[model samples]
Target: MAFGIAGTVAGSADAAEPRLMAALGNTVLTMTDIGPKHTQVSVNDKPVFEDKESDMLSFVGAYSLKDRWIALFQADTGAKDCPTRFRILEVGGPQPLVSYPFGSCSDAAQVTIDNDVLTISMPQPGGGGEAAWTYRNGKIGRTK
Candidate 1:
């Protein structure tokens, strides 16, 4: 799910018509005056990760870097012997700026923003069937 904010300024007696400013989808979910029309959805069957048997699911999580970039997370599931893994997509240019993979099983993940960076934590198998993940630079770097 996503959130946005929209509002217009009132005209002053000494000035012309006021302009509109909005900060959308940063904190909480807000409705926008903009209407949705002619929206399109597309699907790709080709795999981007290494797994061939696993299926991928992508979704938008949060926005950061002054809304110039959005955090996109993709999870690859259904591997024959490996656990599920996830990847992050950076939305600024045409394609994702970074992609990271981790081990865990989850239907979806959440993103938390601090300053201009995003933090994502995942679960992994430990020595005795436990799970832990220490995410770094959009990927899981350590397991505990």
Candidate 2:
């Protein structure tokens, strides 16, 4: 497998454009959602992810970066736009995957994919930082 760092991000997050569309080879995954609050994500036509009862706002975002299917699950931490947790998923995946380590909820953050690396950053949160993850050998490893 050829490894290269991807430098592009493709997705839509506008309030008016509350839909997600991504393609992995020929299998296209389309997500429709009501977001930034109680987001319910439906993939390909059926519901696959939802978070309720936590009183924490949840959101779902999808992207096609480096030919990989990436989905982001974000939960707010009571701050206006600050998120407490970000769960990144490589959809339509090769299983037995690596589990990401998320520290205690500290700040608001967003998710990004770069060169096969998935990063969740909470720059807006005062003491909260960020982490980067890479998928290789069927394992998810933190690179930074």
Candidate 3:
């Protein structure tokens, strides 16, 4: 596995855009380009998640909840039903906590943290309504 450091990737072009980063205590979380069209998430310079699909992945933000770090990412696939989706992941963890369709590719959403609650506000494509989620007991679930 090839690893890139900071602003440049090994044998890859200099990143055209800025990389997304967040600080969790002493650990650093980064979403950087592994190649021209690939993106990977690394914690303290170690690769945690790498998107191999053609869909473009963009880091939305990272937040701290109850002393745990979580990161959100947006994936754009250009599909008809759900062209765009959001991925929730625990920082330094290997898997996503949640992956849900937000809406079209151009749709916008906001993620906010209050105390220990994680709230996501966005337009529902099919007409369900707004959505909210919370992380408790080390698991992520929709607020009922």
Candidate 4:
């Protein structure tokens, strides 16, 4: 009996370099790297999230003023029903501070720093549409 080696699926390999961002305290850090396996994430040189099962396209836009918050947008380039999601990660913490789901795609995101607050903006489905999010005291809230 002969066995066949499964070839790499389209868009499965990492095609971009890892972008590093400084986090709060200067000890914690965040990065987004595209590799042969898939898109990978790291915190302070430690591996965090790895998706090798499928082709993942991700973009990291901006960080909070204090560097405690990070905004990441990700999508499956190969999945038909792949939905774009915004993840707010807290450096050196378990899980993300918030995960917001959106139907529209986001090529970029921005974070606004206010007094003791962080605001995130994501593009909406229609043109010139956007969704705003606020993070404060470890809580996530939506603004119109």
lDDT of each structure? 0.40, 0.49, 0.64, 0.56
Whose lDDT is greatest here? Answer: 3
Model 2: pairs clashing at backbone N, Cα or C within 3 Å: 5-115, 6-115, 82-108, 83-108
The window of 10 residues in a row where model 4 has the poorest summed lDDT is 1-10
Poorest stretch of ten by lDDT in candidate 2: 1-10
Per-prediction TM-score to the true structure, in the order listed: 0.43, 0.47, 0.66, 0.53
lDDT tens readout by residue for model 1, 1-144: 122223434542232211222232332211122222111111121112232334544444546565445444454565555545565544434433445565456433445566755555443334334344443443444343
1 or 3, which is superior by lDDT?
3
Clashes of 2: 4
Name the better of 1 and 4 by lDDT: 4
lDDT of 3 by residue, 1-144 (tens): 344256665777554342777787667777776665577877776676767653688877778776567777788775776777666666534433444434223357777777777776675566667655555444656663
TM-score between model 4 and native: 0.53
- The numbered model that scores best in TM-score is 3
Regions more than 4 Å wrong, model 4: 1-24, 28-37, 52-59, 66-84, 92-104
Instruction: Flag clash pairs in model 4.
Output: 14-35
Off by over 4 Å in 2: 1-39, 56-60, 77-83, 94-104, 110-112, 123-144
Mark the regions of model 1 whose C-alpha exceeds 4 Å error after superposition. 1-53, 93-95, 104-110, 126-144
How well is each residue in 34-119 modelled by candidate 2, as lDDT tens digits? 54444444444445555552345334555666655665555565554433665555656543121353424544445666676665
